[model samples]
Target: MPYSNESHFHPATFILLGIPDLENIYSWLSVPFFIMYVMAVLGNGAMLLIIQTEQRLHTPMYYFLAMLAFTDLVLSSCIMPKLLSIFWFSSTVIYFEACLFQMFMIHTFTSVESGVLLAMAFDRYVAICNPLRYALVLTNPIILWMGIANVIRGVIIVIPCPGMASRLPYCVTNVIHHSYCDHMAVVKLACVDTTVNSVYGLTVVLLVIVFDVIFISVSYAMILRTVYNLPSKAARSKAINTCTAHICIILLFYTLGLFSFLTHRVGHSVAPYVHILLANYYLLVPPVMNPIVYGIKTKEIREKAFKVFYKKV
Candidate 1:
């Protein structure tokens, strides 16, 4: 809140670097980003539409997928428009409050997605290991509470992020060498020591991403045992098939997340551009890929999506 005595004025703006070292070719890069953005939107939108209108999709798995689609839609929409604007129009200026708000939204949605994946893992575990009680285990009331708990956890944990960063006196540079206002990237620009922010960031990741990954892994371990013990190959194959889409999603989401986390922490070994690029990929890839993966791997949703479209024509 207070400016450094040296500057005598609190900084009020931050500049987001669209993509470091690529300003000369931002126009060239915009094409693919634009295409991915459009595809993510349309694909996720279609997934939501079909899941909403199709009666057969009114199940726990599809319900979680719908939540995933909605999260992706929000996640992509929050970042890409500003990123594209920066790339094309060179509109890199972001107000201090706006930057913090963007950071909050990004982190919040990320946590929500992680929680959703964990929910899906549990959904599979119940359906596979306790088929008779699947309905009772993951009823609408339980699912709704899981969703609410995920969101509340995100909000309560992430509140300190922007607050910590904003309270620091940014005396020198306000230029963030990243496309959007990420927690780490923004806090690094502060002239004061950022150990608190850094530690808090790491803690958040450990609690949300790492903890979820471990839980999902354990759930799938149990799932594999259950499926393997099935008396018939048909039953085993059927169970595994049902989990395929969720498995792909979990792999994509966490792999990119861990990579980005590592790159941010120890990426000094590589080019800064490499870190920057991976950071962008870490955020963008899941949103673009999740819908495509689900659309292809999950048969019912895919067929229903086709039906939904065909009816319009």
Candidate 2:
């Protein structure tokens, strides 16, 4: 539906009534969301500390993991507080500038997350397929460059959002269905044509999803071939076990991500709530579960994390 004629909208600014009728659901859902946010913060924080303090985890895999945890911390922080406030205080209104900022941060962190995942896949591929050159291939310089590249990619991909939002005239309804300002959600409110914004957003999604998935698949294929060649059953099993958690994370993130995107574009009314839930899950679940997955599957991280916790106590 086009924007309702409730309020006059401004091109320079817009009032966003966040998540219409959110007050009714806020009281009940806020408690569980608060608990999950706390756990996510603690879990990802502990993982980062363990990786930083432990000498054994100074290698490239753990280095990338540390980066991943940091990204999760950032990604969660960007969205959760505003969501919490909206629930706890029933403050659903957001200013236009603030909305744009939120959208930019969300996209930036999302792009960074994709880049980090791809980097981790490459790390695994090198370790399994070409162990002889693993250390040389994933040197400190290479890892640093990967971090830089991730930041650059995030900035480049999301640069269009604010400009697009700025140009569009919002002369109609301003309520956003979700808690935070999302790219498409904001664009949909625009009174003017949003073809440019939609096209640009779709392009970024394709690059992140299509290009990144292809690279990750290729990396895993090489890793799988190497695993199959291993003579010892124990070695083969161990290698597969090591990759299982990452594979699970990748599947969960991408599947839900694509599903949410598709639903937003194609099947809006019937599955709006489902899309909303999946959108939140796509952002929150990986960060929450990643630590658990790595803690259980990776012996070194598990041991070190416990050791650090005990020492602090």
Candidate 3:
């Protein structure tokens, strides 16, 4: 539907409803979410600091991991502060421009995270499948280029989404069902036909996330095949063990991510509370869990983390 008139074409501000169907308990919910946010920031921040300071971690694998940690930190920060404010102080009204900026930051960081994961998969692929040439294959210059490419790819692809959504005539309602400005949630509020917005959002998800998942899977598949061909049982065990953290991260990130994506379209049957909760968790979980996963599973990170604590104590 087009706007009833040009006078009704724009909304000056939007209000974010923290979670649908749970307004009474929003404060209680904030406790756990606040904890998760703290953990995400501290954990990822520590990992970034360690990787930067520790000369021993000056390799491609840790380099990629640092990139992932940085993305997680920014990603969690982008959503959680605003969300917490909504729940605690009831600060829900956001300017239209600020909402668009938040939408862009959330989506861009998410896409960047996917790209970083793909880069990590490639790092592991070379390390496992082409160990002898790993150093030569992933030179400092190459790793720097990979990081730059991931940032550029996400930024270039996501710049248009907020513009597309923002240009829509949100003449109907300004209350978003989500805690933060979600692209679909915001666009669907527009009185105008949002087919283009929906299609463009889906296309970007497919191109950035689905495409990255496919290539990461291929890289891991090749790594698996190479590992299987190794004659030594110990070598096979070591190879798979090295991948355990990344594999867990991939599963955690994409599984929740895909579920959240599907629920946006096909989740009418589900309770709004459940859908909103899942969506928040989808963003919060990876950032909080990734650093813990690396700390527990990766020997180098774990060792450095322990040593840092030991020295402090």
Candidate 4:
């Protein structure tokens, strides 16, 4: 953390180049971008309201789901408005400190979301694999502690990136190639070698994201194994059905994360526009989709949502 910025070129602001090749149609692109934002906000908002109202949903699984929904809200909100502003108004210049803050919030909530997903997977494992101890194990206090731990872990991992980024000599171009400010993209603007920055960022992705994915995968695998040995078809079907929403979300989240990461790091020949599109998709899609998936897959939530809407109507 000890560094000298005496020779570093500090800029007051950074220019965000919204999308590479699709600059001409930025106004048109904002339409779909706006729709995704609406979907994410309304969907996650509705999910939170539903979770809060339903006393039956005060259980562990629903608690984890609520946390996931909240995380989606924060995760998407961190970037969408700025992206929309860049697209619709060509307001692409962000203050340097604000850009770093955006980078922090986006990465922090993303890591927290991964942790939330891991917690959900654990919830599922306990419910299916050890039904007797589910209540005792994942008590309300324990769940609250898990949520705090997720946020703390994310903070610990990402707090350094922005600090390191701040010390870099950004004598290079201020133009960022993507829609929003991310650690790697911001680092790309730095004129310095940034080897330590790159190493730390890569280490975070590999150690934190990959570790969560592996742990969630193992949890699902064990849950599936337990389901396979169920005494009857009906029980097996029920168990699989219970996990269907979470499994779909896990696949979608990791699939998008992997592709985005690869496009940024490994896809040298890939189109620049594709990189921005994938990056936006990675942030936007899950929040928009998660509520719909949960509503469809969770009978209690589905029924409650319908009742709530029907009453409102």
Candidate 5:
């Protein structure tokens, strides 16, 4: 059987930003955004190189860390270039297909990041709670499967996105208020019924955010129990310290995410700009902060990165 034509419908314009009206705002925001983007790229790129070159970082934990860094690079790349263009060049018009592609990739990477975080949590849980079996449990085969599982989860969850986007009928307006083709922003422009799109989006959030958080929490709780049971004070401190960075990252990502979702949904037109700002932070913070957090917290990674750069110089 042939595939359906459900994916071919195109919208008129990809963006909704009123360029002339926001020239000053764009100019002001562009300076800081450009700096942030450059830092994110450099920081994440450096971490990726360090992970690849440093033999000490060849463990399962660092494998996931490298994956996370790669995801952050993609995530920031997906949004920042276009945003910088809008600010510097006054080019806010995105093609329909480009917008769809951007939305797909953004969601795909974000979902994969969530899955990767879950895998990391599981790794920490096993390492702390089942120390004797940590090596056996997180064997090469298991790490490979975990990577495959994340990719599968990302693709599967976003399967409905293209269909939902294609079905929407764009009538009058096509200007998206935000920097990128976010799910809610695009769906709001559809003249046709948007029930399907909203339902699918909510379903995805429930799975990725709700379900994933519950599992991560359970894993951490078990980890805490195991930490307390450790007979040696130094052992307990070391175990808790290892989890500190991951815990901080989880708290930041989820808190910002929940705030963005709630503010976007409840604030309406009164605070659209606020919502945009918050959403931008959600995308940018992880990429810029993850490398710094890991570098400062993980002594081996920090030392390896310094040594690699020192040798190069």
Candidate 6:
């Protein structure tokens, strides 16, 4: 049996090869992956709950955090069920529209999450460097608009991706090499020249890394300078501590993202399983750790989380 170069002008379904060359061990792998999904859901869900119920967590910082948690929830939820089916039941076929939808949601939410991280950096910068105007600068209406703006940005940036991919002729093979319907993985299966899709995909990755990381880096740099010049040691330590969770999360998120992106293009020598595993972790680990980092590193979140669970504040 051989696949000819038959062009599917409108493919009905595309087959997914979950974690290429690891089909035999998908059941073994699914356990930990499933646990991660559960942890992400519970952790982010709890963050949202605590942020909403607690009166003290109503400020601009917590508002942005709530949005982050919500984004993580959507990100994980969108991919896990279909992915788990592939892992557990060998249900690797996804309808063409569903695959495109998954690609759109994953990329859009990831972009939105990056925007949220950038927004958090801005919040921290204002809180530390411009404390006097924090209240005025970050009003509830302003925070609301920030959330709206991030969503709009994500939608605008990612809408063209699926449209461009859909128009391409996927005539060669329908077997997507990764677990989920990743954008590049889908587009690579196209028979025609995918230069535009390739360039656009690369551009999207570069845009996210360049803009979000640079602004975040700048914000934290100024924050450090302000903290360094604080009048007292105690004040300096407190300011630094306030930003620890955010800094850790930024490092974790971006490092994973950079590696995943590089592997697709430059890391041709990398094993397919290795690349696929990293891609899966890039999406799952951040969601799983965001709540943990915020819970452990942010004192207020830690205390409230414990109080909610044990009734011992």
Could you estimate the TM-score for every candidate? 0.96, 0.93, 0.96, 0.97, 0.93, 0.96
Candidate 5's residue-wise lDDT over 1-313, tens digit each?
Answer: 1213345334656764733245567878888888888889999999899889888788989999888999999999999998888888878888777888888888888888888889899989998888799889998888988898898888889867865786777665767777888887888887778888988998898889888899999999999898899999998999999999998888888888888888876767645667777888888898888998999999998898788779889
The digit string of per-residue lDDT tens for model 2 on 1-313 reads 2432344344443444434545577788788778778888999999998888888899999999898899988888877898888777766767677888989999998999888999999988988888899989999999999999998999988978876776676876776777678898888887788898999999999988789999999999989899999999999998888788789778877887887788878875744656776677778878888888889989999888777778889
Cα error, candidate 1, residue 305 (Å): 1.4
Of candidates 6 and 1, the better by lDDT: 6
Report the lDDT of model 5 for residue 122: 95
On lDDT, the stronger of 4 and 5 is 4
Off by over 4 Å in 6: 1-8, 311-313
Tens-place lDDT digits, model 1, residues 1-313: 3333444333677889778777899999999989989998988888898899899999988899899999999998889999999988999988888999999999999999999999999999999999999989999999999899989998988888987877877777888888899999898887778898999988998989878999999999999999999999999999999899889878888888877878888877876777877777777788899888988988898888788778888
Deviation of model 3 at 207, angstroms: 1.0
- Over 4 Å off, model 4: 1-7
Cα lDDT, model 4, residue 143: 98
lDDT of each: 0.87, 0.82, 0.90, 0.90, 0.84, 0.91
Model 5, position 204: C-alpha lDDT score:
94
Tens digits of per-residue lDDT for model 3, 1-313: 2333364475778889889889899889999999999999999999999999999999999999999999998989888999999888999998888999999999999999999999999999999999999999999999999889888998898989898876677766888888888899898898888898889888999999879999999999999999999999999999999999999999999999988887878878888878888888889999999999999998889999999999999
Regions of model 5 farther than 4 Å from truth: 1-9, 18-22
lDDT of residue 192 for candidate 2: 82
What C-alpha root-mean-square deviation, in Å, does candidate 5 show against the real structure?
Answer: 3.6
What's the residue-level lDDT of 182 in candidate 4? 83
Q: List clashing residue pairs in candidate 5.
A: 16-175, 16-176
* Tens-place lDDT digits, model 4, residues 62-111: 88899999999998899989989888788998888899899999999999
